[model samples]
Target: MIGRPISRIKRVVLSALSVLLLLLSYTWISHRQHQINPQDTTIPSWGQLAEGAKKFTQPDRKGHRWLIEDSIATGKRLAAGISLGIIFGFLIGMFMGCIASVEAFLQPPISLLAKVPQTAALAVYFVFFGTGMKMYVAMIAFGVIPALAVTVYLAIKDIPSEMLDKAYTLGASHFETAYEVVFKQVLPKFIDAVRLCIGPAIVFLIAAEMVVGDVGFGYRIRLQFKLTNMNVVYPYLVFLAGFGYLLDYGLRFLQSKICPWYQNDSK
Candidate 1:
């Protein structure tokens, strides 16, 4: 009974109700705060939110919208960091899982890296890569790579020994066995791992931007917060939540298409 599935209509209704309740709660809180202080920027009303949105969308004297500029800058860094992390993490994990020597050599270092709090190592990243695109990419990549590699490594290890033996018996080389046999089995799980890494990657990127960034969502948020511009901050936060949700939904769609047989937690 606890895990029983609901109808599609029921699911939609429940989801809408949940969102409606959240909006109502926020509106009530904002109204109460406004009553106390008309000038309070902490809990912005709908009008304030609209004005904030316009401020971001409208071009400045330089004919550049802050929202678009920040989105482009942040999007580029996020894309680069996630891509590199996936590539390197997959390779390292595949090797570590399949090869004993590689595992022995790389495991300790990767484990140590995983233990290090990437956000706290901002100074290290700054010194090594400078306060530029490289720093943001490195921070995000390092933040998620270790966990991803470990996920892949474990997934690879979970493969049944009989499968590998059959592949070898049929004249499959180590390379063939690794890719043709092991890779397919692990692809779905790897995608899931990447999906899980998305949030952490965003956090790392935003943290770096907040600390030493000229432009990005994090930069804008930090700048506006300093000015007590809650209206702008709230909209930006909502936009970020929407963006992250879209990324997650896109990944889920991709996984469903590629691995139709694999069971995914869609909810």
Candidate 2:
């Protein structure tokens, strides 16, 4: 953390140095590999695929030749899936944590289902939503919600007895005490819960898109693989990594802003 901050000049200099070092390393290694083999189908080591992005100016079946619509559709599905999925997951998770008998009853079923990989749940969702945004949302939510439930259940169970006793002494009912007292203590961690799943969400997102996406980074990857176009493949990899990184950083920023207390405690 201490080493992360720098003035604009230092930051720019450091970034340039990093880029130069990466280029030099890549060129040295790639040249070594090429000399070892007279005939290599591999494209250039760096910026080879960037040229494909320029090819977007060419033509699709329509006037707009690139898969830009597919990109937007995939992007929309991802954004909608993560935002709505997490909200519903959190609400459903709260129900899981807050109800005693319900929690007990759900445990056996949750455990049974939880042992299964979330991708396996797609068959169930596919039947209901049939490969649309709803299927994607359900897939994302089913994958994510159990982890949330585990966290919330632990949080609720770990609430101090004294806190509950104090609420009781003050004449708060069980439900009121749970909301006003128990929940306040765990709120910071709940924010962390939302932040925690952003990575998993993105991972599942790419997989979901790759499996069912008509257009998106994952689809681009599938397209390039089929065409045997390794040059285009590099761009898709770069794009996916860049998108995931930005999303992770964005969540970190939001977590810091909305959850100053959580940050302070961790520090």
Candidate 3:
């Protein structure tokens, strides 16, 4: 029963119940906090949240909607960073996995990079890339690249030796065997690795934004927090959560479509 599957209806019901319980608990805690201090802005009520939601819809004094501006800025940086990271990581990992010499040369450095705390190295990124979009993109790419590369490397290693032998017996060249044979086997797992890197990528981007961002979710959150504007902060957090969920859902959908034969217990 430990790994038993549940009905779809049960899964839906249980998921809804969990979310309902969380909301109820938060509301109760907010109510109690409000009772103690009528002007408390720490735990905003539903009304405060509604007001905060309006901030997203309405333009600021500069006549720019915060939501659209932040979304575009953040989205572009994130897309650029993650795309670079994935492309380079996959290439490096594929080479390392296929070529013994490459593995011997690159493994130590990549392993060391993976151990490095990317967020803590914010100043290093700033020094190299300066305080602009480049810094944010570099931070995110570096933060996730090592892990993504390692994931691909491991996935490649996990391929059965017999498959490779068969491909060779069929007269496949080394390049053909590496790409046509190995690449296809690892594509799904690589996508899954990318999914896992999403969180860290976002964290790196946000951290950079908080420190030196002119416009983005992290910048807005930091500004509001300084002003004790919990109302906006809370709604911003919810929006971020929703954004992340949508991204994850999109990836899952993509994986299901492309790798229909591949199955996992992700859900």
Candidate 4:
């Protein structure tokens, strides 16, 4: 146990150091380039980044306040979309996983639709949801749901057949067998599915936000890119990376608390 924690700490420290080194290297290169050609604002320096950070932290009416407000709004949108995707995915996936009829009836269409690239469907979503926050939610939910459903279907389908047979032999009804035997056996795996869905959901969120959003990390990135403000953009990218890490960490903590059986093997 001591060794495991030490190893994790070492990895985290190494990763942080690596990021710091890269940033320093970038700043150095950008500074050198700016010396050569004053017109090049492609790569921002440490001073510029400091200025960006100051602007971001300050409650300036013109600059930093938008950062806090936009971040909150974007977080809410991601949460809402991902939450809806998980619920819808769980139900559909559970049905397909447990019921042969459902699998036969819906799997073909779902599999086909899943193959359709999310970007390709953007125009369709915009047509329906009209380029608002609703479009963001729809786009994210659509992107996440198929992958989540497949994960769940596979998880449940892989449950040992003997367990089901035993439940049925003991006079359990279909619903009882599904809920008591199958669902109980596979509950932890649902958390695992949620873990898997989060990455793609964020991707979809960013894509939608870039196009339709008034305020989001993605929107900010797009805005900065056009302005050639690498300083602001880099920090925002780091914030996104940190956000993703924190989100996954929270889910892992939840899994450890709610699905203690998953940790049995660790002991």
Give the TM-scores of the predictions, in the order they appear.
0.96, 0.78, 0.97, 0.87
For each candidate, the alpha-carbon lDDT, in order, equals 0.92, 0.70, 0.89, 0.82
Q: Give the alpha carbon lDDT tens digit for every residue of 1-267 in model 3.
A: 799999999999999999999999999999999999989999999999899889876998889999899999999999999999999999999989988899999999999999999889999998999998888888888888888888889988999999999999999999899888798878889988888888888888888899999999999999999988899999888888888888888888898888776755354
Local accuracy of candidate 4 as per-residue lDDT tens digits, 205-259: 7877888777888887888788888778888877887888888898889878877
Candidate 1: worst-modelled 10 consecutive residues by lDDT: 258-267
Error of 4 at 109 (Å): 1.6
Candidate 2 per-residue lDDT over residues 1-267, each given as its tens digit = 865667999989999999899779867876776688734336544455466666553676667645475567667777777777667556655677778787888777666655777665656776888977787777777667776666777787788889889999999998899788767656667666766776677667667677877776667667777876766676666666677677777777877786676688886
**After superposition, candidate 4 runs with Cα above 4 Å error:** 1-40, 62-64
Model 1 residue 208 CA deviation (Å) reads 0.8
Best by lDDT: 1
Residue 194, candidate 3: Cα error in Å is: 0.8
Ranking by lDDT: 1, 3, 4, 2
Q: What is the lDDT of residue 194 in candidate 2?
A: 64
- Candidate 3 global Cα RMSD: 1.5
lDDT of 2 at 97: 75
Model 4's alpha-carbon lDDT is: 0.82
Query: What would the per-residue lDDT of candidate 1 be over residues 130-207, giving only the tens digit for each residue?
Result: 999999888888888899999999999999999999999999999999888899888889999998999889999999
Backbone-clash count (model 3): 0
Q: Any residue pairs clashing in model 1, and if so which? A: none
